[model samples]
Target chain A: MYTESNEKKLDEIISHYPVKRSAILPALYIAQDEHGHVTDDDIRYLAKRLDMRVNEVEEVVTFYSMYSRKPIGKYKLQVCRTLSCMLQGAEQITEHISHKLGCEIGGTTPDGKFTLQEVECLGYCDLAPCLQVNFDYHEKISTESVDQLIDSLK
Target chain B: MTKVLTSRFDLKGEACDIDVYLKTGGYQALAKSLKELKPEQVLDEVKKSALRGRGGAGFPTGMKWSFVPKESKRPKYVVCNADESEPGTGKDRDLMRYDPHQLIEGMVIAAYCLNAKDNYIYIRGEYWYIKEILEKAIAQAYERGYLGKNVLGSGFECNLYVHPGAGAYICGEETALLESLEGKRGHPRLKPPFPAVVGLYGGPTVVNNVETLAAVPWIIINGGEAYKALGTEKSGGTKMFTVSGHVARPGNYEVPMGYPLMKLINEDCGGIPGGRKLKAVIPGGSSVPIITAEESEKVNMDYESVGTVGSMLGSGGVIVMDETTDIFETTRNVTHFYKHESCGWCTPCREGTRWLYKVFERMHRYEGRPGDVELLDDLADKILGKSFCPLGDAAAMPVQSAIKKFREDFDRRIKHTLVQINKAAD
Candidate 1:
């Protein structure tokens, strides 16, 4: 179900690289952006577009953490739970978000407004206890701030 | 002791804008390199400066460039490692955010030295915002004829692109980076055909860190000896130390190589927050050995000094722990990171990391066995140098060091658990 415009954009991405297969990562990103996750159908479309076996695209989807095999929530709250952030209460923040949303770490809220994830270091340790909501970084967050963020998201 | 690399950082009024960069003497080095010096001469100057790769390994930059085969028939490549996925490291993000064109200018010069027609900056997927900043800067560079199609009329062409990494820490490793760039999973290839010998697209390639490439402009402009005069005998030039965790001023501090570790913590970072006493420090990134708090004060922020203290000056990611910190819990957290990031290429790394994390997880829950520590030591010994890449060794180093240096913490956990079990039995 690749649109004409999407196919055009794919062409531009392919033109940037000497080898056409190098376009797979960026192509997957585009598909994920449109679909919120890569489904079997999206994988088939990408495999055909990039001229690869379906297993090749599926391997990529499984290997990297960012690509979601299942549909994700509107606001994916990826909290930094690595060393520096953990030391500064990232675990507490994750628990707080998970509790407020009535969902587990990787599960979406019942309303599907939020998905809480405990991620490794986002490399923004100076502002520890950070979380990214849909690629927008919210640094040095607290439970209270996360509460406010959830309120603001809806 | 002037601020060479970070001279324009944190300045007001569109810090990353092209006009602001130009006003602060941005492309002058690029112009000079294209107009005045030969590519070999540029390489020689970097060689003389003794700039080490800032992406953890600290290999000499000029020496790395010298490895790119001069007679290769295939198209050479220069891949800039902007992944910066190591825990406690945020300096590269700051560099890309605040001073984008500086990195671009550095990459241009580096590409020239290697005779590479095209270059790529493989950045972490999380830093999409910073990557946008870099792309804007690159567009501006091209508009001004600084990047593409015979850059600055020097009869040399250079094209630069930004590639986003899809959330894998192993891609930060040079060989894995090339694999990911080539649309494969981020598994690091075996050495002997090192990247310099056969890299991206089966061509002789040179992979350098973003921080290493960014220093090229300054080295070329001020000359190599001047840059060399900035730091210690072997470690020359200023390094961006990412001082985080338990510090008052948790931020990126660019200091000369031989800067005192205590001074950086006390003066620059305003010491530990809330006046807590220091317990220990990961003087480099989490992969390196952790130095005890007592030894950290005597440490210098250089390669040799940190190494002499039994830890390499890795990635300049200084993670400080205060008296209130729990060594056992922190070790579990660190172990968990390696276990999650191990690429599963080698059996030792894949299995060793998983078991290492499981042992720590059990201990944190007070279910540690009597010989768990010995079990850990044996597993680490088996994994140390046997894996395909450093991922296995990285998992082993900090865990091994923590158990050795802080055995009391592990003993305490086991004893507390056993006491609870006996009380329940009674």
Candidate 2:
């Protein structure tokens, strides 16, 4: 169940496409924003609203790396672990954050405040060793800066 | 020096604003095309420009446009591949973030040529900020009559919207992008009925990269010949290279096609930092073959020249690695990327990438078998061109080339494992 404002937002996005199903990705974003991660109930509601099978919505949600099927931490610390980032010492950055958070890569903090993930190229290689806290990018970051970032977030 | 694609980058944050873009001669090409040039003439200019796709493949842009059926009954679509997820590629991100209007103008010109009214820019979800910037610019374009039911008082109508992908690299492939846009899994479709013929809601479609589309307005405004004259006869026009890793100046540099690879690394990028010798370079993105510094001496940043040195000018993502870098670790890292990104659509790619990654991981952990190097080479060969899309080839090329050029690195790992095993047996 989406808020009235969110429902209005979904309606507006759906109007942009000729087919209602085309808006599923954008609609999921709204639902995720409303309910943290995509819950099973959210998928069912989206399937019914968009006139699609539940499996269809589930597959799309599961296929993409960004969408979360279950609940995640408030702060998703996604470090870029691809070629360029690695060349600039992304491994050390990931390690530093992992140490600071007291969790391994792909693990969430005990308090559910932060989750660390090793993401593929974020297209910010020019600013290598970059990471994203939620949607905000922290580029060309040093281990010290990463430490500061965690402290600030905490 | 002639920044055709990134001429407005100097405007900094203000480049995204329509007023600044207007002052700096932004949408004049769109105006020129809509008023003076016919659809065929517009297309002819692009053809004469000799521009190739900037999104890795380097296919001729004009030829791709010509593939769409001219007299199609269904609504044609012009989809901009703004999914700049190639490992080292970030030029498109800059193009869209800095000069959103340039991309919009080019898209409108393309839509006019294709007789398509509805266009979508499928950007990666990670670029949510850039999406907002693009959306704001699109709003500005709509307000100024550059888009909507009529454009700049011309009868031709166009509507442009930004569509965000939910984080899948395979979606960067044209067909996979179309599939994702249709609210499905980001699995690539079979070729033959290419996007030009049957694409985007089962209509004729033309998908061009952000950098490729951003160049269209300039090609139209300054006659195609003028644009072509800027670079090599075959390559044509300037390209933006996102030079990263080891370089003192790791930033986006817009240089003419066929610019010397060494010059970019030395003069433009300030060479490898801390006096480190350049060990290897992934001239393209992670997908292209790696070239040693010795081989890179004669290489130029063009499709043909880079090809001669056994690499591609893919997405113009020049990833430099210094002598201190270990080739084995780097290859393992890259292999893991393919393993994670593989869509599992094709059996060879789906299974091959996972197996290759597992072998690389074992080798990295010093558990490599004696024939692991040859096995990786064999696996890469099997996946090279045996998949539904280029993703498999992308996954395979880097691994294959790394083994060819840096065989010693793999051999050294296997030797270390062998020695350890012998000592244990003793």
Candidate 3:
């Protein structure tokens, strides 16, 4: 399942590091981009390409929060519930999204349109009550405007 | 008063791009170091500058660099820690977004000083855009002869690469950063073999913060003493404080060390919103102990001054709280953050943060018993010094300090709940 173009990107990433094992994280990112999420086959392919054990590759994948072992929704709404964001009413924003989507914090919507998660600081405290749909940030969002944000996502 | 690091942040033209950076005197310090100064001379200048680490600890940057052995058969490395995952810290992300080349130039100078030809920047996964910006800047630097083989024709060759992390807050730790860079799970290794001795494939390595490294170019250009003169004796140069929560103008402001904490909040940050009364302040990131508004007024934004007031100037993140802010809810939110971020490597941290959060949740839900506050303090006390890393203590200190400074507020919540229960029974 490792395409030729994916292989080229892996090679370019590996070129930067002195050891091939150091390329595992970047290679996994590329593999995840190619596939929806990291699969067993992707791990096997990465282990073979990087000359690492399958367990080593899987260990790295499982440890990180961002890498999804299972498929995620189209739009991942990662609401920052850290201290700074919390002060700016991030909890209400999170609760509103959860109630509106009819899914739990970590659950995806029935239509598979969005996956709502309460993530740690996204490092944008100035614009508190921020959440990221994929990597795009929506800052200083209110519970009132959250409906518009969800509607506009499509 | 002087803003060196962020002066170019809002400059006309493409501020982040390479051409604008070079045009506005980028890489001049690197050129100067390679042409005029020897590697030892550069190190000496940094040592004289007294610039502490901008990353949480405030360790002397020059001393950290000096720890790297002069001779090592193994390949040496310079790792720029762009993994700014701390709760109230976003200044590094700003630097990476607006001035990526400054970080590269800083790393290049550090590598030349340490004789390290290879460097990797371990950036957070969420900062994908920042990484891309850094990569673009690196490409431009290579094309411009500021980076890559025989940089500036000085025969001081160095290569810099941006390595993206996979969403682990622990990777921000230097040892954990090295482990993650080696493509392993981010677990903090023991410190006896600190990165300076055996690091990054068994070689001497120097791990500096984004702001710390970015400050190097200015320090070198302006001369060490000139940079040192900006701040207090031990804490040199201006620090970029990320002011957030309740502040009218919540953003990053680079001010000299020893700047009055209250003055920073009132003047630079436009004071608290709605002209509300100040209650508490988290002088540093959320990890440090909380300080009262009265205590904050007496303190200055420096390592020693903040410490003298019984809290640290950790990461220079000033999280202000107003009178309208509920102490119980704020403490609960903070405890929840630490509980979520615990790496699970340490038992006290893993278990203690969870327990603390549960107790806070109970208190939040009006299930607070008489001894709940004492229980909170007891749990925090147990976790403070028992953990392997600073995170456990980070979670504990804010809880402990909140109880110390705002016990009356939490007590009022518990007393009010009792009154409601009595009234219902009657």
Task: Give each model's whole-structure lDDT.
Answer: 0.89, 0.92, 0.89
Query: Where is model 2 chain B poorest over a 10-residue stretch in terms of lDDT?
Result: B412-421
Q: What are the per-residue Cα lDDT tens digits for candidate 3 across B347-372?
A: 99999999999888878877777788
TM-score of each: 0.97, 0.98, 0.96
Worst 10 residues of 1 chain B by lDDT: B412-421
DockQ of each: 0.88, 0.92, 0.83
In terms of docking quality, model 3 is high
The list of candidate 1 runs beyond 4 A from truth reads A3-5, B415-426
Clashing pairs in 3: none
What are the root-mean-square deviations of the candidates from the true structure over C-alphas? 2.2, 1.9, 2.2
> What does candidate 2's lDDT look like per residue over B139-224, in tens digits?
99999999999899888889998999989999999999999999999999988799999999999999999999999999998989
- In candidate 1, what are the lDDT values of residues A20-90, reduced to their tens digit? 87888888888988888898998998888788899998998899999999988999999998999988989
Residue pairs in clash, model 1: none
What is the DockQ (computed on Cα atoms) for candidate 2?
Answer: 0.92
Alpha carbon lDDT at B313, candidate 2: 93
